[model samples]
Target: MSIKVENLKHIYAPNTPFETIALDDINIEIKTGEFIGLIGHTGSGKSTFIQHLNGLLKSNYGKIFINDLDITDEKISLTDVRKKVGLVFQYPEYQLFEETIEKDIAFGPRNLGLVEDEITQRVKDAMQLVGLEYERSKDKSPFDISGGQKRRVAIAGVIAMKPEILILDEPTAGLDPKGRDDILRNIKEIHEKEKNTIILVSHSMEDVAKLADRLLVMNRGKVEFFDTPKEVFKHEERLKQIGLDVPKVLDLAKKLREQGFDISDDILTIDDIKLEILKNLKEK
Candidate 1:
């Protein structure tokens, strides 16, 4: 029901010109049903870290425990691990190969040897979760959909597996503003309805700021902080050093604070800040 990583380290092409530390002595714990926003600049090891959660990248250098099962142990079932921790990588839609959207979404569940009826239900339910109309899109080729809808199909494929831990790396990458907003809302629905341990990786502080209950900031393969968004944004200089700024909402809050606004806490979301501003105006 949780993921625990200790001293995780990964080196790429060691002893060669491409040698680099991809993950450096990382340690963190993720509890069940927690919505975590994983934020870091490009090459900050965010992808590398999430890959290890599902056994996609084995770590001989560190130990990872998922749901209290040692992932590295010989007795562990990697297949089960993957079934429990579903990962949706950037451009996941590109991996879609089935002739029809229904088949593509059903692939994972089918592989689990689910009954035909169960697989069908899973496909229907997953598509519904992603806002895809099962009756309309089922027979259509995945390539025939809009880019955002294609992405939804890919994500539905993973959700069909009913993974306990869902890791989404830049789920909104390359999306337009409205596409990004739609995807973020879909993810929130998934978290709320499924109650999975969700880890959303993105560089956009604003996107994560609105959805994440907790933020995990990374820099140079190291964890900077793992705390509630309000608490984490309080370290403005530390975030700046990592080439990240606090969410603009919080930045505005800070500026208003200096100008004699009596706002007492960091405002991490657009909605919350708007409410506060309106309340203050009404009071005045």
Candidate 2:
């Protein structure tokens, strides 16, 4: 589903001494099935902005349209909107409350009033999408699983709803390298197979560089840049001013270029840089 935000504004503690502008006239359009990477410093309104997408937060000013339907309209049902836009917050495992893994993942679909057979199918599909073996894990307690498994169960709960637009906020936060890789790979597979719109909010530049089709950079409640990763990373100085950095591989490529190596600025991954170095060695 496509999302369009126009002149969106949000405030905290409005009309009070502690009032703050959390989102300032933000405007952006996300096309259908696009993978967008949202990056910004802490408190830069990244969280606040995403909360508006699924109606968790209301804007003080402006309209938000989902697939051309005005979600900001009072006539629109937030519940219905949420069905189309699923949001998985950081450490979603903390929200798991069902006695068994199957029940936990089934919660959203069950609430949608789906039939028993359909709900069961959704639960099974969600677990498989996240790499969980349904028969073995369904009866297990959510709390009895490892941290990464718990995280997958939490994500599967949201996936069971079959949202067209999925927003994941720092999905890999606090996990070890292997755990993080596992979750990220699952997410990539989900996007590839489902072809749904995904907005990934991440702190790791490398992750976004590899996954996102476009990068949306926020700065102090405003858009600093929105472009392809290669284009956005071109402004290394500007990103640094906002306390952001290019992927380490890109940074290394830049250093190599300065030393008279024929490194392409388009290189965004370690594998890309490695291949380029090998190609150059072959040419020599």
Model 2, 58-158: lDDT tens per residue? Answer: 99999999999999999999999999999999999999999999999999999999999999999999999999999999999999989999999999999
Clashing pairs in 1: none
**After superposing candidate 2, which stretches have Cα over 4 Å from the reference?**
none
Question: In candidate 1, how many Å is residue 205 off?
Answer: 0.6
Each model's RMSD to truth, in Å?
1.3, 0.9
Worst 10 contiguous positions by lDDT, candidate 1? 259-268
Those runs of model 1 whose alpha carbons end farther than 4 Å from true positions after fitting are none
Clashes of each: 0, 0
